[model samples]
Target: MSNYSTTTLVMTRVFNVSREKVFDAWLNPKMMKKWLFTLEGTNKVAQNDPQVGGTWEIVDHRDGKDYRAIGEYLEIDPPKKLVLTFKMPQFSDTVDTITVQLKELEQGCEMTFTQDIIVPHEETWTEADIEKALGEYHDGSEHGWNLMFMGLKELVETGQISYKG
Candidate 1:
């Protein structure tokens, strides 16, 4: 019985590309700018130092607002596995952990993304508020990641970035 609530989000997508190419997209600044930020914003800043203990940050600007995400690499196994800390300071104060695993298939590579979010308790938050907030966060995260993955697949396969919106 942990005091904090944990929400885990998992998504898997197969890219029609080699494992190395698929893995490189997550770390390469140029590739990340092209596919990683698919929400309403455009990526304004993308910086990545892909190594154990290295940090990365991206800023997306849209509608006169800036959305920033920062993280540090925890574990990096080239073209195979990556574990990192993900934080969106504008949204939440809690830091989340994201683990990405890549497996090479006969045709392409399959990537699995898992995010574990720790929901903190606030004195002013009622049960209903907490539930609603968590639900929205979960849904938004799923949708956003799915869209980004679609863009990633397109970029890695056809060398084009296509966003649904």
Candidate 2:
């Protein structure tokens, strides 16, 4: 197997919601539609099968284009930990894995989100080029996840959330 460089993007958030509720948001189609990562789009397709090996897919319809996020569950421990693959076929063929770990707090819970970003080096690309590309991906991903986290916070806190909000 070829060894490629890997970088992790880690983010943590304290949600004022129970662990199960926060964890369920990652699996439920309705909740996922409201808070999962997406570009600027009002229409979304969220199909999730919350099981050890089941796959989940989300498609965002925006500006006459569909952006799909597809993945398979690698591990699932209710209200505690979840591991899954995440890939956007519209962009790159590289597959990445994400882990969501939730710890119950006195009031609510803290979620630690981790994603492994494997840098794909093209034959003609230099080391600097690879590093630059990785930076862009990391920054863009962090921004998108932050937006989705905001929506999630709203959904769990207020029982309603929207992409536009």
Candidate with the greatest lDDT versus the true structure = 2
**27-123, model 1: which lDDT tens digit per residue?**
9888888777633238789898998999999888877888899999999999899999999899877888999999999999999999987787667
Per-candidate alpha-carbon RMSD to the true structure: 2.7, 2.0
lDDT of 1: 0.84
* Most TM-score-accurate candidate: 2
Q: After superposition, how far is residue 84 of candidate 1 from its true place, in Å?
A: 0.8
Clashes of 1: 0
lDDT of 1 at 57: 90
Stretches of candidate 2 exceeding 4 Å from the true structure: 1-3, 38-41, 162-165
Off-target runs (Cα >4 Å) in candidate 1 are: 1-3, 38-41, 124-132
